[model samples]
Target: MESETKQSVYHSATYHAAGEAIMSFKPINEIHQHLCAFHVYSSDHSRHVEAHHYCKHLSKDFHQCVIYDSDDPNARLIGIEYIVSEKIFKSLPPEEKKFWHSHKYEVESGLLQLAPKSLVPGAATDIAEQPAMLELHQTYGKTIHTWAIDVYPDLPLGPPNLMMSYIGDGQGPPAEMVQARDAASGQDTAAKRELRKGYLSSYERVEAADEWAKTGRGVEFVVKEVPLKK
Candidate 1:
């Protein structure tokens, strides 16, 4: 009788309605996926934090994404990334532009990928090889990581960290990290690189963001100490 009552509750209309309400929070227009790695600014480019981004095109020129540590059920909310077209990027002030990073190396080296089937259900290919990826290959991203889950492991421990993307050859995440990610995702980063070779000719690398770093005008490292509120 107890098992019957439990089954009745599980199949009740009210229970199903509650489940539908929870699913309603996902926005209907989120259509693009960007899978990539971000390096901790303070880590001297040694640690690569994986980010799985589901993005929505707010307009023809703008996009916003919420990044997760992974795509699994236990994935953690790690950060947010914003992207803009080259025209919009040029309109920004120098200081604002410094906050953004170009996607050239990320796309060309196959460091940036599309979310796998585990995350997006049917999206396991070289995102760069897709027609939509052509536009993304030209876009710029500005990302801020709020949780240092790689270092803290259990909880977010401090203020948000300014993350940066790899800029050139040999600057991307370590080979072992990429290998491990590929093993779990069942996707080949090297194969994706081969698929993107044709794109290399037409893709124009955005150098303005990196230029700011060379001039030492971008955000530099700083330490802050504060007391936690009770």
Candidate 2:
């Protein structure tokens, strides 16, 4: 029964953003399925959250965490919690960094605020080495900057690294143009149809990877308060 309630709140909490009437709203088992696919929970499933926007909301109640050697009995979970008062992420002092040197944990903030509906997709998932069905870029004046990140749970094995792709305005690439690219290199899929289903094309990939990393098996998942840009 407790599990059912958790699922209900997760769903209604999401519709609050879609501007759908919530008066008679109720959670459905399908809610978990959607979250599993999107890796984020937003008002509308179509919009992706941007960097500044993501930081603003997620910092309110979320945190950045690290996971250490799970095989060791004394492993720890280190939290780089949102320090609103400081306007910067608060991490354990240098001494604590020693322990954080190794581990694997993810953004623990709830879905309500971490992943917004106004930015790009794949905030927490890895991208393929091959051409993407869609290539999204942000324009800053006449210069077009491509903001891309690889969102895989298991990775190069270290701290998270941010990656970027660039395209110029006018000459900039189409956001939805698809090309042949290797998708099997990672745990995510390569199907154009499956990739483009939600608000953001690559949402399912990220969500699934995040879930597998945390539970070792696929489980309904959600994340909040992760910075879109460093």
- The most accurate candidate by lDDT is 1
User: Residue pairs in steric clash, candidate 1?
Assistant: none
lDDT of 1 by residue, 37-139 (tens): 5554533456678888878889878888888888886789888889898888888997687778887778777777766543433234554336656767778
Question: TM-scores of all models?
Answer: 0.78, 0.16
Best by TM-score: 1
Candidate 2 lDDT tens digits, 83-163: 121112123343322111110111111111121222234433323311111211011001011221123224333332211
Considering summed lDDT, which 10 consecutive residues are worst modelled in model 1?
120-129
Score candidate 2 by TM-score against the native.
0.16
- Once fitted onto the true fold, the runs of candidate 2 whose alpha carbons sit more than 4 angstroms away are 1-52, 57-159, 162-167, 170-174, 177-230
Error of 1 at 153 (Å): 1.4
Angstrom error at residue 109, model 1: 0.5
